[model samples]
Target chain A: MNHPWTGPRLARVALLLAVAVFGPAAGPRSGFETMSPELRAMQQDDLANPGMLHVAEGEAQFQQQGCTACHSAEAMQGVAARYPAFDAARDGPIDLAGRIAQCREERQGRAPLPREGKEMLALSVFVAHQSRGLPLTPNPDPRMEFVRRQGEALFRERRGQLNLSCGQCHDDNAGRRLAGSLIPEGHANGYPLYRLEWQGLGSLQRRLRNCMVGVRSEPFAPGAAEYIALEAFLAERARGLVVETPAVRP
Target chain B: MARTLLRVPGTAQRGEVVEIRTLIQHPMETGFRPGADGTVQPRDIIRRFTCLYNNRPVFEADLHPAIAANPYLTFTFVARESGVLAFIWEGDNGFSQTETRALTVA
Candidate 1:
């Protein structure tokens, strides 16, 4: 019998078990599918979804910041689906928020917004909202391959006091109960989502940090390269999943 | 400044019941919570929400600390005549916001 206590061995076993049960290629499913009917209803109703408030705030910011001077709302459609794109200036992959921050600094000649601040969240939500209902389309630039691989490694690497990889719960035990909450497949299609736990809209990075903390691991600093890499990987992993920016999560 | 969202039917038949939904962004900090510095954060919450139809009060609610951040309220009012509907929220820290929407009734 294979020992299941070793980190890599356990992770491999978990993956094999997942593949055995789910088949070689399981269809991408959204976290929305796992939510209760009430939450699903909440997410569907624009009037009731609190995340729309951020979208409104973002709209105001977009106009006030002269974003309309270069990009109209129509021009922004499907932009979010192609995130974590290669940034030649940074010589690295940059997520949508990072790209926005860079634009504010380079093009708008303004200070970058704080990563987790309200202004940033509003802008991200607003930009992402443009891509709502579109599929996540990862950047096809060959340079992104390295970062995507790094993200996959991070997803499968076991760490923290619990010695758990993200795939262990999100991939292997998806749909299973954990502390009374169903484990989702950890797709990034609906990001800058409004989580009831946070009582506010937050970026995928915030959720990732929360998970890291859950496993007793030190989270990467906000806007870190690692987070961007992971985002790139998640984008590819969640390919074809429709964007649900500002989605409500219970 | 807090962002607010208001939804109302653009037109309705006279005597028809119409639903009005409003959502506003606010922390609604319950004074009982401690801040990062470990001191009790002073309470800040939207204490009241009032809706006026044609300059007359139609709905009013007294919000408390228990209300979640980003308060959302949905209520109904009878359509009578074409007029402006006003929403006003009052809260601690001298917070207040007023928004108006026009409803056409046939």
Candidate 2:
């Protein structure tokens, strides 16, 4: 008679058991928590935070575009927390940036803002700023399930010359040193943030693309479905983490 | 137009020291860096910042490319009287911005 349990299967079972017994090793930690005190102080101080400059620019752009005609900035509160939402027109998930572009094209009868452009970054940053301190609340639509699943698969799938997946570093080796910097859990709670490396405000997609480049992988185009899906999954993963739009990071 | 943020106390007691903070949006691109096209980027930075209270110079700074983008500065001055505080920043590429705030001393 053959034994049913193989060595690999037994190891997998043991790992699962350990996970179940101990729960996750740590609770979700924001990149903000991992930042140096100086950077943290920069993020906390509106006068010092460079991201506030983008927020100011965005506010002016919103008013110039007559966004106030439809709704006030206060009305946008909590909006950013529920992004990567299902779009009926696209029949897919759309991130906050995409929604803004769509509204510009359809609602305003104007050309959509260019991805990663100064205007777009400013607008998105401004919109996201309104949701600061609010917990991320990803859309719960059943339609989003498929997108979220795709995002999860892409996140775990190994690719690139480095032969590493996002989860391999962010999930399995978080808090470990990579080069001179600590590997963060890769949450998307604070986005359209100011990065000292970039010396400017950048969107979450830009950050993801940078990671792909670091791994020597071909990055998807801006506004790609893969990115939107990934953003949806990240929004879900980052649920309960407060939005820290325009956050400062080294 | 470049954006600037100014933080000056709206009110202070006479002879009390008050802090004034300012932040300006600028790339402050050092000439040493190469662009995406493999071309050397020209140096651009805020070269000077001046603060005047009641038309009298109170503080001044000469910035350089070594300074980071979005330059921020904070300084304190004794409150003397109700007056306007003017901030002026001059930089490369003919960049210049002026902002003013009113302060009241009781």
> Which is the leading candidate under lDDT?
1
lDDT digits (tens) for residues A1-250 of candidate 1: 1111232445445555776799745567778767899998788777788998988989998999888989998888899999989999988888888888888999889987887898888989999998887778899999999999999999999979999999999889987899888898899988899999888898999999999999999999878899988999999999977788879898
lDDT of each: 0.88, 0.87
- Displacement of the residue B69 alpha carbon in candidate 2, Å: 0.4
Candidate of highest TM-score: 2
lDDT tens readout by residue for model 2, B76-99: 989989999999999888988889
Q: Each model's TM-score? A: 0.90, 0.91
lDDT by residue for model 2 (A45-141), tens: 7888899899999999899877888979989888999998899997878888888888889999997778889988898999999988777889989
In model 2, where do residues sit more than 4 Å from their true spots? Answer: A1-26
Least accurate 10 contiguous residues by lDDT in model 1 chain A: A1-10
- How far residue A210's Cα lies from its native spot in candidate 2, in Å, is 0.6
lDDT over C-alpha atoms for residue A12 of model 1: 45
Question: Which pairs clash inside model 1?
Answer: none
